[model samples]
Target: MTLGLDEEHRELGASLRAWAAGLDGPAAVRAAEGDPAETFEKVRAAAAGMGLAGLALPASAGGDDGSPLDVAVALEACAHALLPGPLLGPAVSELLLAGGHPGSDAVVGLAPGAPDLVWDAPSATHLLLPAPGEDDTWVLVEAAAVDVEPVVALDLSRRFGRVRAPWSGGVAVTGLTRARVRRTTVAMAAAEASGVARWCLETATSYAGVREQFGKPIGSFQAVKHLCAEMLETAEAVTAAAWDAAVALAADEEQAAFAADVAGAVALDGAVRVAQTCIQVLGGIGFTFEHDAHLYLRRATTLRALLGGGDVWAASLAARAASGVRRRVEVDLGGRDAGVRDEFRTRVAEVAALPEDARRAALVERGYLTPHWPAPYGLGADPVTQLVVDEELVRAGIGRPDLKIGGWAAPTVLEHGTDAQRERFVRPTLTGEIGWCQLFSEPGAGSDLASLRTRAVRDEAAGGWRLTGQKVWTSLAHEADWAICLARTDPDAPRHRGITYFLVDMGSPGIEIRPLRELTGDAMFNEVFLDDVLVPDDCVVGQPGDGWRLARTTLANERVAMASSRLGVSTERAVALAGDATPAEQVRVGHAVALATVCTLLGVRTTLRSLAGHGPGAESSVAKLLGVRSRQDASELVVELLGERVVLEADDPQVAADVHEMLMTRCLSIAGGTTQVLRTVAAERILGLPR
Candidate 1:
């Protein structure tokens, strides 16, 4: 959940946190506010002694030559403690210098452009300024060479000043490019932003848990819980985005700029939003000067401002994405499975050599289709092996067949069904011979699925169960060969209990499927009516009262499936539609791209955890919530880009598709689980907010 994932980075973060705590940064800031001359000299010296100033610089520059990720972890910890004094400016300046510039030990200020406010100007020994009319060129000058007019800034933690410098007097730094400098700056700043967001979220949630109102803890209220949940989402988004930006910068990949732009767009603004929400959660006490909440808000706001505003970053991101820049997320297994990888590659190649029609069966036979499942049904592959198989399959251009509803159904059958049931269903479903649909959601029990009214009565003469129920929003019901049905077996039992998981044949007598037209005018979903449909006793999964537990397993499988899904279709379409977009439209597109990227990062973090043999983190649930919003927003943005053309239904097929997509995405929030209900779940389960 923090910027650092592994043990080394965690240790570094912990060390920094301990170090920052000793500084009592807020008190130092308070002192600086009283005496501008008290510039925290000891604090700066301590940071320098820790080698943080040149953390990302090369060893030739007297730095440790650490990766940008290392710097990010340190910055995040420092920012969480509200550490003041010139960290960002000095670090950025060192990176820009790259060991060649003459001021490695000097405190440096960054003036992004001409007549721009310089950060840390009062204490800066040198200034980094953009070269006049030189397009991406920058110059380094001593602070004495420029005139600085100190400004009263919103962020009390740091000082700012407008600098008047002769552009020709500074030494032109040719080693660093504007793109490199900007990306580094934004990435590092985003790390700090994430820290601010993390602090806000933790502070708010902790305060809400104990803060009382109306004879109860405010966190017990749904509204407050939801607010804290939302703050968690934003804070996680900020962390993921910033972490990704640092990763990209350290790797120096082709799409590094795009990644940094995403951080700039999402992390900076998200931090500001989280800080503001933290204050809201803290109530009246948060609004006062004595509270530390506004300080974080000021810091977040300042970072966003210094980075050329969120809109600018968003537009840049959109423009880059429109030009076909995508941040590729690949898992690095660190050669741990060299032999396994080679074996997978050979097997995948063999499968690829088979006729396209035979590939699915080949994959299923070889256990490549469901590597994470148990042996025979799958390879019982660990997370690393699963990822390796995925990579090899993609490398061989072999796309795995989507199991659709069978994905959920087959998993449950494998885990909880009898041997005969697995033999009859799992392989056929895997091979696409037997299509499956779910009959769980009823008219009144969608998100509250346990409240389903479908009833099942035992038929002693028939030696099976007679089911009668109406299931709505059943995807692929009309085309499915079978269904996994949930029906109440005991009306007097608790809502969740007394239900039985049944495997029902779609062609059973008295079963009817009526296609339901969606807003997109498609009948992909259906309403299934079961009138005394008979399901054999052998088709029951687990015991009569085990349906709820089995249903949870099925839902868990669905979440796993969702987690492995690619970056959404809507995000890609939005990028495609972003060409020639207006600035305002670009901003929206940029925001969408940032969100989509964060969703991917969340998945990456989850995978990394799995690779490390750790349990799943909160990223999985957060990813689902954020993914729905990302897809919905992107799809809507696509329609907005269509503008007046959206009214013309069939005139332009692409426009029609865009419109349909927007409508289709509306189901994302409603389906699986409603956003509101999921938010409450996240509040209780993840954030530990009272229901």
Candidate 2:
């Protein structure tokens, strides 16, 4: 979660964090305020002794031969302790040197744009600057050759200075290029920003747990809980972005610049925002210099500024995306599933050879359609087998039929239903012969589904039950042959205990479906009225008064699906809209690209965890929350780009489609769970905030 996924990286990060903590970083920063030069020298020497300076250099150069990812892991740990001095500059300089430059061991300063101001100039023994009037050329000059005037910086932990020098002879560094230098710098800075964000989140959440107001902890309050939850989301985003950038940079991929731009766009700004929120959570104490909150805020802000601000990064990202550059995200798998993959590929190929109309039935017959389900119904595929099936299906150009509500209904039926119930529903649903609609939510109980008041009374004479309820926001209700309903079977029982799960025939005499038109003028959702509908005893799933538990049942055999590309539908559309975009539009597009990519990375991390035999991490839940924002924001940006055409009934079909998409995305936050409620859940359940 702290910019590393594997055990080795975790151990490295932990070791570095322990080392940094022992240094008393805050005290070091305070000491630097009085004697900057001496403090930096001492800190630099200690870092060197710890082998931190040579982490990114090759082993041939008497270094660790660490990749950018390893250096990022180390940087994240050091920054978590608020380690003072020039860690990023020297590491990035060594990365650029690639162990070829003779001055690799020296404290190297980075002059990204203007030579007048150089980062870490006060502590740097040499400087890397762009060659005069040469766009791609770079030069390395010794700091002793220039007149260095130390300048006061916002970040007291690191030093910056003005370099007074003429455009003269210097060593031409062939290893350096503007793109590579910028990407490397952004990747390292993002790692540091992630550490700052993580520390702020941890500090604020810890304080929230014990900080008292009135008669109890402030964390018990909904407002404070929501704030802490938002902080968690932001901190997670920063970590994901930073991690991905480091990975791409280390791989030396064609999309490395694109990934670095995303990191710069998301992590830098995200860190600053999280730090500010941390201060807000800490109340009056955070405003005083005695608190460490301001220090993190200063570091985050400085990183964003030195990297030319998030807007510039976002613009560059948008440009790259517009040119069709996309980052590929996939699990390495390490050939562990080679045999299974070959078997799946062969079976899938057999299915693919069939006529288009015969493929669905063939897939269902072989348990290829729902591979994650238990045998007979599916292959009972593990995560690796599931991925192999998915790849083979895609490779064979065979798209599985969407089960819609059946996907949810059949799982419960399989888990808790009678053998006869599974026989009646599972296979038929998979074969697309039976359609399902979920009738769980009522007008008054949407996200708080346990509050549903739909009643079911025992029909003693008829040997059945009489059901009466009003279900809202039911998708495909008009087309469904049956429904999975939750009815209050015992009025005397507790709220959650009284419910019963029922399989209702949608064609029953008293059922009525009313289409509910959305802002997009579509009727995809509906209201279903069930009045005195009869359901036999055989229609119920599990025992009576057990609907709540059955409804919440999540089979361990859940399907695993991953995005094929980092750019999602809305993000791709945003890129298409950026052809003639204004500067403001480009920034928005870039921000959208960064968010979408982070969402993908979160999934990638979660998938990686599963492949490694680890339990689910925070990424799964966090992905849902961030995904809604990313989709909604991208769609809104698309409509905005369309200008007046979005509002007008224009001849352009694309404009209307864009407008519709923008409106339809409004339901994303409200569908599975409202954003406000999810934030509360994230705080209480994930962060362990008091209810």
Superposed Cα deviation of residue 355, candidate 1 (Å): 1.3
lDDT of 1 by residue, 113-137 (tens): 3347788888788888877678777
Question: Residue 580 lDDT in model 1?
Answer: 62
Q: Scored by CA lDDT, what does every candidate get?
A: 0.85, 0.87
Clash list (residue pairs), candidate 2:
none
* Least accurate 10 contiguous residues by lDDT in model 1: 555-564
State the lDDT of candidate 2 residue by residue for 1-691, as single tens digits: 6887877888899988998899978888989989988887887888888888888778777678889899999899999999888888888888888766444367888887565778898888888887767768888888787777888889989988786656566789885778898898889999999999999988998899999999889899999999998988888899998998888886655679888998989999999999999999999999999888999999999998888778888998899888888888667778888878778888899999999999999999999999889979999988888888988898889999999899999999999999999999999999999999999889999999889989999998878899988999999998999999999999999888989999999999899999999888999899999899999999999999999999988778666775567577778988998987899999999999989988988888887777767767777888899999999999999888878876675668887778778899999999988999999999888888888
TM-score for each candidate, following the candidate numbering: 0.94, 0.95
Q: Name the top TM-score candidate.
A: 2
Model 2 / residue 598 / CA error / Å: 1.8
Off by more than 4 A, model 1: 49-51, 101-105, 113-116, 131-136, 164-171, 251-254, 554-567
Residue 210 CA displacement from its true place in model 2, Å: 1.7
